[model samples]
Target: MKLKFDSFLLALLIAIGLAYFFPQAVLFQDGKFIEAVTTVGVSLIFFFYGLKLSITDIKYGLKNWKLHVVVQLTTFMLFPLLVLPFKSFVANAVQENFWLSFFFLAALPSTVSSSVVMVSIAKGNVPAAIFNASVSGLIGVIVTPLWMSLFLDFHTENVFGDVYWGLIREIIIPVILGLLLQRYLGGWASKYSIRLAQFDKTVILLIVYSSFADSFSSGVFRTISTSYLVYVFIGVSVLFALIYGILYVLTKYVLKFSVVDQITAIFCGSKKSLTHGSVFGKFLFLNNPSAGLYFLPLMIYHAFQIFLVTIIARRYHRRKEEESQ
Candidate 1:
């Protein structure tokens, strides 16, 4: 078998490089034109997300309460706990920004598209994957900010309220609008899912470019060494492996789930969403120049998970084929 490179990952790297070289072009100047476009883009992304959801599918998915519970717990609870213990170590060995980045990565919800796609690839519970991944974003809208508030002292007087309002405006409201209009738009949305997905990726890339531009302009990357970046990569890789391993054992042996459910658990439980990370970070870290550092780990984790999970999904796909044969 031949290895395939992810073109989006390449695009992401290019976006970052462009930001570093042409910060002025990408940076949001006083929340002007670029900001307006990005804000609308993000809202539309969620709106499409809502349009794609099927209430019937989610209701049916709820029957697999055990699997749903495990995946959500692994995403919101276990992942954060794994990183919390390293607080003291990170404080001593790494910068506060990096520690915050790692914690942010841990606290994010699972990716909506990739989790479902990976589970489908492994011949897992597709409906459940869809339900879990969709619900996870909604849950993260509430949970992730609360988790971050525990550590970050916001510059605003009522940061939590502001964060909630941001989510309501940028994410929740648009999602609800999409849901409301789903009856009329659902068919079109489904028909254009691939195109909409490309749109989503493009919006995310624009966000990435803007974020890195801000960071580069502020000279945030200058403080960190290449070796430190390597350390972060190793740390993120280990975190992914640990979660994947734990979920594997728990789903397969402890829960005694079917192979399909096991595949869903491992894939869904072990992933994080860069989309949510970027969108949420915009509001949470507003005017914070170090915002770029916060996204670094998320980008790394996103790329790493795609690479690792593709291999795992392919292996499981092959195993299923052989067994059927």
Candidate 2:
């Protein structure tokens, strides 16, 4: 039987509580250790991600190019443009540079598994969704930092130096290696994907835990207030709704895609990439434990997008079934 993904989300919440409640945990005792664990754990997650994708999947994915472009462009480009105008408004009202970095997070790639899985579950174009998610990821590694440099000004300070390529190598290079060795690895990959899906959720929880742990360590939680939390939630909820609404109008009317493709586009387009946001965020805020600052606003958006898209995907799936009947 397939496990309920909600269980994983709940487990992640529990893990976050573990890290938050135990601020002085051993992982956070040494900065270097926490960094090392985060690095290793994230790489392992990507390695398994690579192994999970196969040659057949890639070929299958290539068939739906329109679905790929529309969804990915919306994800890695259009969403950021929508969020950019909010930057000046937020800048006028808010003073936190880290919160502003959330604008850049909106421009990054889609998540690997969730984007693909959500579309698949909704009976959309799974192959194209998977391909778009993976390609957008590869593009994000390069394009994201470049956009950051152009917009966030990380390049001017030379913060884009050293060991960052290791992140690329771990995720992209391994996938290429897996593709090259698919004949041998593909069999093992299918067997482990489920277990690794659990690991994927755990890895994300670890990331959230470790990151929030740093904020806790630095007493950053004190800086955040209940009113601020309420605003963040409300703002993210609005943004999620707006993105989905815009994409739905475009896909449903302007493009006239099949209902499945429409859901695929909106779901994939409307979501932000937490994996890249958290990982690349470290580079953007290097040497600062408060780096979680960049992550904070984007984190609310991630949760909001998933919740909103789940409802939309289910509705689309039901409509699809009724039409088929």
**What TM-score would every model get versus the actual structure?**
0.96, 0.87
Clashing pairs in 1: none
Model 1, 62-142: lDDT tens digits are 999999999999999999999988787655423788888999999999998899889888899999998999999999999
Model 2, 35-98: lDDT tens digits are: 6776777777676666666557768878777778887788777877776766555453234544
| For every candidate, C-alpha RMSD to the true structure in Å | 1.5, 3.1
- Which stretches in model 2 have alpha-carbon errors above 4 Å? 1-5, 26-29, 90-94, 151-153
lDDT score, residue 141, model 1?
Answer: 94
Least lDDT summed over 10 consecutive residues: which range in candidate 1?
A: 86-95
Q: How many residue pairs clash in each candidate?
A: 0, 0
TM-score result, candidate 1:
0.96
Q: Per the 3 Å backbone cut-off, how many clashing residue pairs does candidate 2 have?
A: 0
**lDDT measured at residue 18 in model 1 versus the true structure, 0 to 100:** 93
